[model samples]
Target: MTTATAFDPMSEDYQQNPFGYYRAMRHEAPAYFIESMGVWALFRYEDVVTTLRRPELYSSRDWINNALGEFDPVPQVPSIISSDPPDHARLRRLASKAFVPGLIKKMEPGIRGLISELLDEVQDRSEFDYVSDFAANVPVNVTAQILGADKTIARNEFKRWTADLIRSGARSVLPQEELDRIHRSVNELRGYFTELIAYRRIHPGDDLVSALVQAEEDQQVLSADEVLSLTFIIQFGGAETPSHLISSALWECFGDPALLDAVKTDPDVLPLVIDETFRHVSPVRFLGRTTTQDIELHGKVIPADSVLLSYIASACRDETVFAEPDTFDINRPGLSRHLALGMGPHYCIGAVLGKMMCGLALGMTLQRMPNLRPVADDVTWLPSPWVRGLASYLVAP
Candidate 1:
């Protein structure tokens, strides 16, 4: 086994929250080799920022390659996340135009309405599973409205399917039976989207689905397969990641009565609080990329074609970057430097939308259900190194 693989990143210690091990890595092994996985992890802020900026040199090729190519290998829906340029460039251009700032802003009112209705169910109840009752539904519903899909159908099996996808990333190397169900889900999901795309083509509307379908009708648009993949990407991507981030952030806030009250009273302070929570408990703990060429960091060499995982969660807590790094203060200054959304061209495309949606979801819940509280159960985290979030949170007021 190589050095990187020696320390299992998915261990309960790391999975519970990896700040401790990552902190050790920053000092004792800033660019330490993992014997088991045969990769290097750069835990410090400087190395992460530098690595993210030069994607051409520190390539995203592997993530795209493994994700779409080898990860599942079942041919149902394919996404651009696993493709390389010029294909990557082509798909990204179309998507960037689709997600332009003005276009995203237009959905705010509709998103707010969707949030209001979802929380409406919990208004009369004393306790609720924050993950399912509230968090899981908001993003998918908001996305459905944007895509002109039925809000009713959008909520169906959202939690289970997305959970399986996250788990697929984890069991990529484990017992096959653990993730066998995901393959069937993927096929069903693809066919579900395939029908939706076809319907949108025949009868276009103002939703995103219609928009993409029109793109195909008007010109040489994205392939049918690309549409299916990006649609799933938009649905799951727009939904799962931020939904859990919102949950984790709330867990931190409500978990602390003092912090919870502060945000409740000061409405203006909520946005900053949300942003800071993301910096501290970023939804994605780590992501891997291959080195396109040899590079140097902290005086250590990273050879070409080598795989590197940047621990953004670790970078946010670097002592040199922020004061009292371990403390979770929503009001902390300069928390923006955290690489939660990553850096450079390949940075998360849905970041702005994700932020708006998450902020709206949390803001509405707090405003509507100020007394909401989680039940007495250990928060079960999603099983994946790629995404860090709870599987569910049972709560009561």
Candidate 2:
């Protein structure tokens, strides 16, 4: 609508601190096209929410396939994230059954125990990387437990596979060799899930994989490919987003003494603190969609099949939505309005699980490490266009 802007997401300045860039886009170009990325970027809260909610108008199917031209083969199994109704509806319903409230509530004791054990292992160290020592492992272990994965699958292996899979999915332009590596990682991850699914079929357990194995839709069960695809989505979604969230929440606390003191003094506000963190520093920065039909938005006409990037991170900080949008205030009113977990049909299926893991991780960290503080102001962030998270955050107790 406004004159298109040259927004380079991969630029050093944007990667290091995107909030300023996001603010600029929200002000100057709510629906501006990024010449470099070849996608129309939506930054306003209302615009992003509308685009996400109206998936019928803006489809996700093969959006990445179109964007990743000549890079690597398009994924064979389109997960729920990439599907449209009635297929999307069917897959989501079946998957939702696995993450019902009762099952997640049952996971609390195990989640707390895992957090305690991790804190114990790091308690002796004077300084440690929050991401590696704590944040990264929690979700992988939790997801593994929920999926009834073989304990033989190393945690580090899970982390590596998940990270590669996520990198492979991003719109960022990566080198050919790196893209090839990502492709190989994708195959390895698929093989792992295939083997896991086969085992679960023969020896079913009270876990998500087994549930998906038996999940029926109108007298039809999910195919092997469907199960594998869903497994891939669940593993990465459950692991990466929540891990980033835990680290981001802690990063916020460590950077603000008053915030840290508030949480340490009144742990009751831990959930609110986590919510505020999600609003202020959403882990998943943006999601891609394709225009299903030519549409007019904010005085711009986006043609059919054009790629559109809905910047959730930017929307969460929209001045129109939140009072003091940039401030990390736990008690900010109407925090639920934030689109951190997305909205409408494709709202993150793993939202509840992510919250549980993050809440426990933060609560336990504050309790166990009473003197928790950042080791340095320099934090290394994961280099990806879509995911906003630190690769490592140095901290000391």
Instruction: Give the candidate number with the greatest TM-score.
Output: 2
RMSD for each of the candidates: 3.5, 2.7
In the range 176-242, model 1's lDDT, one tens digit per residue, is 7765687767666767778888998889876777766656323668778777777787877777777
TM-score of 1: 0.87
| Predicted candidate 2 versus true structure: per-residue lDDT over 160-249, tens digit per residue | 777666666563656788877877776777778888999999999888899899888678778888888788778877878899999999
In model 2, what are the clashing residue pairs, if there are any? none
Question: Model 2, residue 49: displacement in angstroms?
Answer: 0.8
Cα RMSD of predicted structure 2: 2.7
The Cα local distance difference test for each model comes to: 0.74, 0.82
Worst 10 residues of 2 by lDDT: 65-74
